[model samples]
Target: MSGTELTVTLSGGSAADARAVVQALEPTFGAADERPGDDGATVHTATFEHEAADRPSDGASADAARLSAPVTVTVQGTPEAVEKASATLSRTFTTRDQGAASGDQEQERELLLEP
Candidate 1:
């Protein structure tokens, strides 16, 4: 992770759906340090670094990826990072902010995403 790091956990959808959501974030957040795996896990996880102000897809459209089903994404990191990730994801998918919780230095936000 080069800058602010955040780990994104996704579930309630096929593995492919999970990967699509993560890839959708690549333009703004940069490619993830840890990419979503092809393993047949019910829950998929990936880590990304926010290369602040280095967004390659400045006006990137959400045409890069699409979901086959609803997926729940949980982003864990500093409050700022979590918020940023949620915002970026929302631009691509129809999402509902399920909820959020914060610890001393870290926060977790869950978003229910629909195609």
Candidate 2:
């Protein structure tokens, strides 16, 4: 399927906090492939299908949305996908521009999400 791949790297948080963010994203991005990072960090990588950004018709419940700890999310894909994902993430977390560096095939934006 045509879609974007997003890698969310969470550091300086407990495993529970990392998992909470991953769980919040799963309904939208599907199951993520999680791995450990240095110094008790967690990294979650997932691909979002093109339609994944569409808001649910029934609306999302408040309990389904949450985030915590310091995390850095890197979204890489077409400009459209990157923008969509960034917007979605911004709503849930306090984000600052880490950077946006582009290459020939794709573009990437780094956002730091604060607790």
Best by lDDT: 1
Which stretches in model 2 have alpha-carbon errors above 4 Å? 33-44, 53-68
Model 1 worst lDDT window (10 residues): 52-61
TM-score of 1: 0.84
Collision pairs in model 1: none
lDDT value for model 1: 0.79
lDDT of 1 by residue, 26-104 (tens): 7767777766667878888888867644564443346644788889999999877787678878877889999999999
Relative to the true structure, how large is the alpha-carbon lDDT of every model? Answer: 0.79, 0.59
Candidate 2 lDDT, 9-52, residue by residue in tens: 55545565556555555555555665332345355554544345
RMSD of each predicted structure: 2.5, 4.1
**Each model's backbone clash number:** 0, 0
* Backbone clashes (count) for model 1: 0
TM-score of 2: 0.63
Our model 2 lands, by Cα RMSD against the true structure, at 4.1
